[model samples]
Target: MELLVIVGVFFLLCAVFFIRTVSKKKAVDKAVDVDKDDSYAFEAIGALFTAAERSFYGVLTQSLKDNYVLLGKVRVADIIKPQGNLNRSEWQTAFNQISRKHIDFVICDKDNLSILCAIELNDSSHNKADRAQRDAFLSRALSSANIPFVEFTAKRSYVIRDIQNELHQFLAQQSSQTPSADTKICPCCSSQLVERVSKRGKNQGNTFWGCSAYPKCRYVEES
Candidate 1:
């Protein structure tokens, strides 16, 4: 009976030791997990702060529009129109010539009959010799096309207000120089028709020119 009692005492002691060791291990693991979570939280907060700083400066410096903010206001169709980026390829094909380079912004009046001005924003990276050569080539092309162009730098902190003022001034000057209307001759029937809007699709209320001959002369020009 004494031997059995001794065996029971030994087993109880072993269990107590095992429980204490497991508890200690669990406490250490919990502390490590807490530290890891804290570190990740700090990193996420730091990234958020950095992104906020960039966005604030972009708004102040007008770089947002120069980069991609203008896309929000302008439709993709407008951007790809013949007066804008699409003019590059159209002009090349029309003249049977290819340009060595291309211009960035092509601002025009409401009618889009003539290009009023072009604006190019350059960054510090574009200050390199190669980029300067490209700019020079694009400038020559603009000159050949009888278009005026301006270059600005974002690194110099050109603000949004500054760009707005410049654009307003240029538009005012262009309006004074351009004629009120262009000579329009109908392509289908050679008739003198007035500009009108299409009464179809989402553009039902939008401006477009149509033939006065109605069903007989089906002609349209977008305004």
Candidate 2:
């Protein structure tokens, strides 16, 4: 009888402990339910580009119209990757270097959207030691990837023709480096095909690939 009584008391104590433990857990969970009804607040930005950037963007659009696809604030990691046979840690280290950085503008081939070159609108901010260091690293990285990089000063006014001419030079660079038989070349004079805007023709405003030799070669290809 005594053993039975002790056993019953033990069982009763066990049941109470279990109930108390479950209640305490529930109380703790309820107290810590921070996500229940609270909402995170956010606001939309006024604009993505600053005054200088906006001005430059306008110039780029005017100059590049159907010539190239300009993607702004492109993350560097999206364009280039760590090359060849790296261990996990090395790959991660390389990725981390570029993941946080972005190019102000990336020019892509309009047809296939292949990255062509990267451009930066450097204002006074880029003159700092830190900024200069960042610029050098990015220059090296982009060059290593065979992606040409250019910088234009943040000026109150930019010449449209200058931008067009510089961009044309970079676009022609890939084919000019070491022209393979398959590379696009001016068939007439066997010279590098250069991007040119029609100055006086029915397609005056249109851009096209013409021979760098121009008057002498007179070879033109539709771009």
Candidate 3:
């Protein structure tokens, strides 16, 4: 009887250890899955920002050529999408004196070697008082420096084409006082037929003169 009782106790201890080990393994698996899902979500957001930047550049390029504004000499920076508040802290502090959502773009005027503008694109999720306050601060900063600061909020779902049109109108208004004689040359090929903004890619919003002899004498420079 004593031996039998000892054997039963040993079996009970083994079962308890087995259950605990299984539970721990399941928890680890769950954590890994959550991390993977978060990574995927982040990648998706990055792709969206890239697309928006490209669309904005395309519109600006077309508008400049069609409207004969600034002789297509304006320069736009690449779209800068910060990952989190930490990444955007410095810019936020400069504009709003606080760290919040990331900035979208830092635009410049290559003609006079001055910063022309800064743009922020907000989605439905950004409709909070904090965001408004930040925008107000940015507006004040830009206004004081005689620079243009613009904001665009999605009416419903974010549409790339609509945003592009809005950007074109804003650029036209801003460059109204610019002179046509201020034609910019493409730095790469020294071509005078250069148009502002990059021809392709995520840096599409960047203002640079590209050669009309693209693909052959491809050259570009920030206006």
lDDT of 1 by residue, 130-211 (tens): 9898678556555444345567665533467766666553344232232346645568865444454333457866766654
> Model 1 Cα displacement at 88 (Å)?
19
- Listed per candidate, the RMSD to the true structure in angstroms reads 18.4, 12.4, 13.7
lDDT of 3 by residue, 115-169 (tens): 3446666665557888778678666544443345667654334455555565553
User: Candidate 1: which stretches are off by over 4 Å?
Assistant: 1-100, 173-223
Ranking by TM-score: 2, 3, 1
Q: TM-score winner among the candidates?
A: 2
Residues forming the 10-long window of minimal summed lDDT in candidate 3 = 70-79
- The numbered model that scores best in lDDT is 2
**Backbone clashes per model, in order?**
2, 0, 4
Reference-based TM-score of each model = 0.34, 0.64, 0.34
Query: Alpha carbon lDDT of residue 115, candidate 2?
Result: 70
Residue 31, candidate 1: C-alpha displacement in angstroms: 64
Over 4 Å off, model 2: 1-38, 173-223
What is the lDDT, from 0 to 100, of the residue 36 in candidate 1? 77
lDDT on C-alpha atoms for all candidate structures: 0.51, 0.79, 0.50
